[model samples]
Target: MRFIAAFAVFLFHLTMLSIHTPHGIDVLHQFKDEGVREAYNSVFHIAGFTGVSFFFALSGFVLTWSARSTDTLTGFWRRRFFKIYPLHIVTYAAGLLLLTGSAFRASDDLPGVFLLQSWIPDARVIFAANSPSWSISCEALFYVLFPLLLPLIERIPASRLWWWSAAMVAGIFAVATIGHLYVSMEYQFWFTYTLPPLRLMEFVLGIFAARLVILGRWPDIRLAPATVLLVLAYALALQLPQVYAQTAVTIVPVVLLVGAGATADIEGRSRLLRSRTMVWLGEISFAFYMVHLVVLLSARKWLGAEDSYSTPKALLVIAGCLAVTMVLAWLLHIGVERPAMRHWSVRRQDRDRGRTTASV
Candidate 1:
């Protein structure tokens, strides 16, 4: 599911760049007919941004689901840092190397390198050095707060968790409505779209949903129906005004899907998500998400500064870039991510020692 969501974001980026930039092969505009182009945009373009929302929710759910009672806050932080930063640093450097001569700025570089870029309102800063990594900034905020938040979350009585979840959802809707009505368009984009604090609500909801399931208080919502609700909500979101659309419109469905997946796992019912191929892909999904934009942008640069290509050629380019991105992602997962987690992550040495003692 994470892999699928990451790929959706990748597709969204590709289509968006095709529409806005002159550097890439314009995949969407390849169709000469206006109607075909509009149809393509209508179907493929609107829903891709929801992938990020999926990720935010999934992060909360997965982290909460796997959290150990004995785990220390420092230990959790160390593990998360090791899990994400190595890949982020590598990709950030790669993006810098690729954009060497193109509008690079020292001001943006500082925040970007430290994963603080999202704090700034400027898109150039927020999207600096690996544009996709701005989300990491948000994730960092979530990680920092998780230890503090979890104890409070666990304190909520299981019976009342549903109401608590509802309250959070209501809060999200309220924030969205206020932002839509009161905030200016420019600031609204910063506040509702890129701001880490605002985005933290989705993460919080994820935590809440997971706690409900942990207590066996999760609503008895099946995976299929939850999935259907997600699709419907996403479609309805697309029809909404841009302000509301960019807000928490699909948050309810996202939470439901995450909760449903968790329930599926706990019940030991076999699902497509547990399949080996998907499991592998999900493992590398973070790396894939980190590297894909650079891969696409580099491909565009290599394609000789052309503004657009014929439909077949543009599609070929997109396919080729995706292939290369996946290969690089797999290599990064094996080389950088796996090794770092094994050696540098929390309690690896202790775990190994325990295993040795057990074998003896």
Candidate 2:
């Protein structure tokens, strides 16, 4: 799931690299006579936006999996905050510094450092060297509300909660679809697209899936057959008219993917995500995601390239970015993320021991 989400973001950047921006910053124009534009555009369209959908589904799955085991809201928030905010702040701060000299005034850099730059479009979109950080801002909003919303479903018995969860799913789809149509992306982009509150359904759906699993509702599903069904559903969703509503089309395959993860045995599905390579990628996915853009930006700067808009150049840029991202991610996982997790784990164990001693 993590690899899938990270790959999607990778594809998003790849797609963005192919298009011409208003500022004439397009790299492809440099090589336009090469005749690869059509192919590049087609591939970008297929792979790019789908990354966001994958991230939404994965976020739901991970959050629900954790929620199922959370003993209290405090622990849940503690775990989530420590896990996400540290890396997020690091990435955003890097962007603030990079943008300070050119894109933004030195005075605005301080405010941007704290993520208050989102309200200022000129600061966020134009100034921030890492424009992709916008998604992280939205994700932070999701992280804040998730601890509160997830445990609510667990509070009620399955008999009553199932209906409520289903209704909530329906309500979320309605709002997303209605909002997509009625609200302009210009005004509502942050609210409808980026904000976690509006996007809570994806995570909630995963929670309901976990609830179903706990209640023994999920079939001990076979791997090959389930994978086949998932592929078919994904194809159907893609073939549907774009006018058919975004969330409606997206939620179908996303639901299936989450369902497969919930029901399918990890060992039995050895060929899929459970494989050693995919598992390793998933493990380093967060670091890969946070640092990949940084690598691309740095590489372009180093190579004296402005942007990667041409097909060959974009491919080259992605190849270089992936190599650097993987190496950096592996290093960070070993040095930073792993140690942080271990330290947190040890502290948690000590606290539990202290509480046990007090009770005795």
Whole-model Cα lDDT of every candidate shown, in order: 0.81, 0.59
Q: Which tens-of-lDDT digit does each residue in 16-87 have in candidate 2?
A: 442222112233333343456555544444443445555665676667765545256566656665665566
Candidate 1's displacement at residue 97, Å, is 0.9
Clashing pairs in 1: none
Candidate 1 scores a C-alpha RMSD against the true structure in Å of 2.4
TM agreement with the true structure for every prediction: 0.92, 0.77
State each model's C-alpha RMSD to the native. 2.4, 4.5
Candidate 1: residue 296 Cα off by (Å) = 1.3
Candidate 2 stretches with Cα past 4 Å from truth are: 17-35, 46-48, 67-70, 98-100, 105-129, 155-169, 219-246, 304-314, 344-360
